[model samples]
Target: MLKLIESLIRYEIRQNVIKERDYVYVRNQLFNLLRIEPTDQDISYESIGYPSDALDPILDILEEQHILDGSKVARDLFDAKIMNVFAKLPSEIEDLFFNLYKKDSKLATDWYYNYMKALNYIRSERIEKNEFFKTSSIYGDVEITINLSKPEKDPKSILAASKVKSLAYPKCVLCAESEGFAGNPSRDSRDQHRLIELNVNNEPWYLQYSPYTYYNEHAIVLSKEHRPMKINQKTFENLLELCEQFNHYLFGSNADLPIVGGSILSHDHYQGGNYVFPIEKAKTLDSWKKDGITYNLKKWPLSTLVIKSKSKEALIKKAVSILDKWKNYDNADLDIKSYSDDTPHHTITPIARIEDGFYTLTLILRDNQTSDEHPLGIFHPHADKWHIKKENIGLIEAMGLAILPARLKTEMAFVKSYLLTQKQLPDEALKHKDFAQKILNEHQIDKDNVDEILEQAIGEVFVSILEDSGCFKQNKEGISAFKSFIKDELI
Candidate 1:
């Protein structure tokens, strides 16, 4: 434990989160946490690659000593306890971030992201284990990631978590209260977490890095208050304001309706990151100019309207007008109904960024109304695509990046064997049998190329899924109908 403590301090120093002057102070803090005596023996340290190198073994020793149970939940809680001791105070971090921001926004974010990783708050080591790949498709290079960052809970831990009563102190995971909160079995530990408070369009907001980074520098911007996500004129104004604050990042939000919105609906938030999604690469299918703003129809699967202008106010005004029209839009010919009786069905997954001095806002039209044939929203990923992804096509996926379930990692292995040997899939992967067979019929299979074939097939499935979510089909009639709406309502 002493050796690990020395190594952790050295690692943090190497990462620039700490310095040589604070050696004794940091070591004493850890010793107190472990309830151990101070050690006078000199220890040498080296980086074994990541912070987890020193932290994981320390956590294991704590479990062996019965300081924490050998369960994922317990280990998670205690490890955060250890890391937070080294993390800067929220105020210190905020001060440093703003100081850097005054010079350059990119430098500020770069430092912030590195600091979060250095403190193990971003869990960089585990996120690297996630299965990530990109395959070329008609739209662009569609990204598929079989997420494996989240550890599978053991049955004992699962049972314990199930028995714990729920508490609502934080209200939701995205709430401001999550910072420095000591999580229980039912919640995740955020002891090492910090939030940088910012004002967006005169309203309080906080910025934090996502622990599970699907892309580079994945960030969450959340409201200070607990409120549901609602896209309005103010949403456009706020998005533009956020972009001004983080000029190099793209900010977006999921649709505000069920089956098309993000997993978190109770709390309002937007995700921003430095990575460029496939949707941004899509070409303009057609374009029109009005009121000094250029509106382009994107050639992507999702029904997207790209609003571009030099004036921020002009972009927001036009976007809000389009949004208002969409709320009441209906076209029986295309099976799009804005509402069924009193329940509304139309919304948009909106993305904002600055491109070549032009403020750009992309609105992907979404509807959540269900029919008897497809109870899970007519625009959702259909039943055929459920073998891969059934979750809502949130803002990220609408941008052509698929965050697949962790189960795909194992299920695809079984699928590969079945594809080569004609072996029956296990009960666990039965859902993949038909999809795998389709792959067999489409391409010649061999050991070296089966994996590539399966990956491309998954990419194709993701494309079709996006097409299904599209309010306008990519056909002549569908395109015509879409144009009519823009001409009649928006123009």
Candidate 2:
């Protein structure tokens, strides 16, 4: 009977009727139904409001297994109460609920509890940091600093205009106001900082920051409000008019499909910037000159688009038509099994490449989800640990410092080492090594020497992993294979 109740609750939770926020209430009700107090509580259907008629049969089954007592509840009763709540929920909510529940078996019941804890931590940290900033008179005058203190006033209008809703749970720690403000002062202090604010045809515009920028000059043009709409001729024309003001500029959008990662804003916007290097190198194809439309395929991890026309009006119309087609075809809710058929609008980042005195365009699509077979989600070492004293690990590593490595080695060595020592090398590593060797051969390296170098690198990486579980083995072969794959793909 307890098992049946547990199954029911699980189903309901997955169905969405009982949300994570309501877990406390549900738990309380279960406790009441069981008539169990904190001091001497046990699992039993009778204690938990089971009908008298239903209790006998369940009791008999429990007695047969010697798993129940008249005065105390069965252990499975606790499980059943939770499961019953989930089972009663509607279907739409089931997938996300179950997915999260199954993600960490031991912590399923503590989902809301953990989230609240994280939120409290974020709030406390934000208050503590902001209090310092508030008292620091030296940097208090900047608009960015002021904005952080009053983000609610700004309201992320662009995201709201684009119809992007905040996470249903609440308080997105990923791009919260506190996180943005925390980095504002240093970013504003940079020497090359230039604010490129633009108002498109008098429509209110907001600035957008890029995620993982590959160029010095990168930003997005966003609508004043968070809303969703098809990019029409007027929209494109306005953007094109803005584009003409700068020679080295590229424009892109999230479209209605699976929006690109890091575009947390739901506002209608287009990303653009004046990059230092020739953006064309990032494209895949050599040239895209079909009739009036041109497409330049970009290198891996870079996507772009370039349109040339006799008149801005014509260009805008063409671009709008192309985008509209993509939007219609790439419906997010559709379970389009064939990935190749999916539209590129939201999945790929488009980059405009100019090469050999001609304009070209490139598109770099999202990585294939099926390719990630690792048991753990995509997480690097030290992913969870936050460094209060240092800057971001990415920036530090990029600058050739090993602050993270040193800290992990010294502070977290024991646990890290244990994790690494337990992992068995997956077979895919060998295949990747072979593929890397092929790339080296093509590059005119001696096959034996290349293999030796790769083997040595792999062994060293593995040894490091064994010593510090926090460190992942650097798969040089996998890196080489990825490079080769990208080259071939672009060709």
Candidate 3:
């Protein structure tokens, strides 16, 4: 089955390559077949040839193979095959084919018609959901804005301000909502002392400490608005300008659903900085160089791909197209509904390559759910989690990265704690817990046979918090330890 798929793909690539090579001859033959006036008859007279009446034989063979019917289908299929075959020929021979069969070929005419139909279908689909943005001039324009509301310094005042209500954990005043406040001083100290020195007076474009500092020089780019849509060409070009000006690589995350752990205040933003420190390291598996494009397969991702390209325009276009295809496939598949978060988004990360004048254009797809695994995998420590134990965390730790747990233990704990204090869990929280539990069960973890013995203990604490606030108050030390582990080993 895989070989058959590869053959189909090769056929498509061959068609494209041929069209690119013998474009002039193909165009002249196509025009003659359609009885259209040539732009220059002198050139057409020189290029055109007698047509080959081979459509009938090809159609008969296809019909025998059950790939065609007596209707226009047979004729259409034959024409497509002819075009594909013509495309594979050398330019000189392709010109001869065109001149020989130009006026006499119904196959070429049908092929042209079918090709236009396919092109139209593609264009229509691309514009179906994006017509408004594409058609409107004003809607496409964008401006960046930043909000610099540094939190209060006094702990009491900050704690008081952190008492804002949250649907996820209404009763917990210092939930993840207070993450910024709890770590703000350390972050600020790092900014004022270490990060500022690194900035080296880089002008208005300054540096800030990233909330998640898995990598050195990690910082978020703020827009004035709290909400923004797609990362447009202007933002990308400006980011590239910054890259050139600073001579540093920039990495960014998308809103709605961020892959690189976005934690802003429901705001529009981008992120970038230097890549001096190692975030995730994996062995390079294979490398290939061709036409200014470098292909690489890394051990971590276990996938084949071009790591960098000379043509930025082509690279971006291809990456966006692949992501668009993935989104379309996700939308069509019921099992992968979570992959599409009711919005389309992209993240472009620039990396300094080993080869000069080239950079790794990392294209990250952003949405509510990342992989098939649950997002909570972010908190799974190597020592405790059963999955990590079974898989050997040494591999991941050696790579210097973390996986978000497929279970929602942290979120569950938060909800249960809130419920114990407030008397009831929110409907949404309960639903998420149920869904997460279902996934756990599918992985063979159930109440009777817990997948991880530790998870059961953690689950009991979560249940206790929902049932009685006194339980959470008694287990404060355990909660602190778990949170600390999450901070150090995961995020």
Using lDDT as the measure, the top candidate is 1
User: What would the C-alpha RMSD of candidate 2 be, to one decimal place?
Assistant: 21.9
Residue-pair clashes per prediction, in order, are 0, 59, 20
| Better TM-score candidate (1, 3) | 1
List lDDT for all candidates, in order: 0.91, 0.34, 0.34
TM-score-wise, the better of 1 and 2 is 1
Please give the RMSD to the true structure for each candidate, in Å: 1.1, 21.9, 27.7
- The sequence of per-residue lDDT tens digits that candidate 3 reaches over residues 172-277 is 2112222112122122211011111112124233223343233334444444333443444444444444454344445444433343223342544445545432
Q: What's the TM-score of every candidate structure?
A: 0.98, 0.33, 0.34
- Where does candidate 2 stray beyond 4 Å? 1-197, 207-214, 228-235, 259-261, 276-279, 282-291, 297-307, 327-491
Worst 10 residues of 3 by lDDT: 131-140
TM-score of candidate 2 against the unseen true structure: 0.33
Would you list the rank order by TM-score, best first? 1, 3, 2
Give the per-residue lDDT digits (tens) of candidate 1, residues 146-167: 8899888887689879988888
Candidate 2: tens digits of C-alpha lDDT, residues 1-491: 54433433343344344666765566566546544343333333322222212334545655566554422223223223323433332233234334655665224323422222221211222222221111111111111011121112123333333453333321222221222121121111111111123457777664433322333334556665555533355555555554543344555443233322333434466656554333332234334454465543222222233455444454555555544433333222222122455533323333332334333333322221221432221122221222211222121111111222222222222322222342332442332333343344444444344433433333332222211211111244433433333333322
- As for lDDT, the candidate ahead, 1 or 2, is 1
Candidate No. with top TM-score: 1
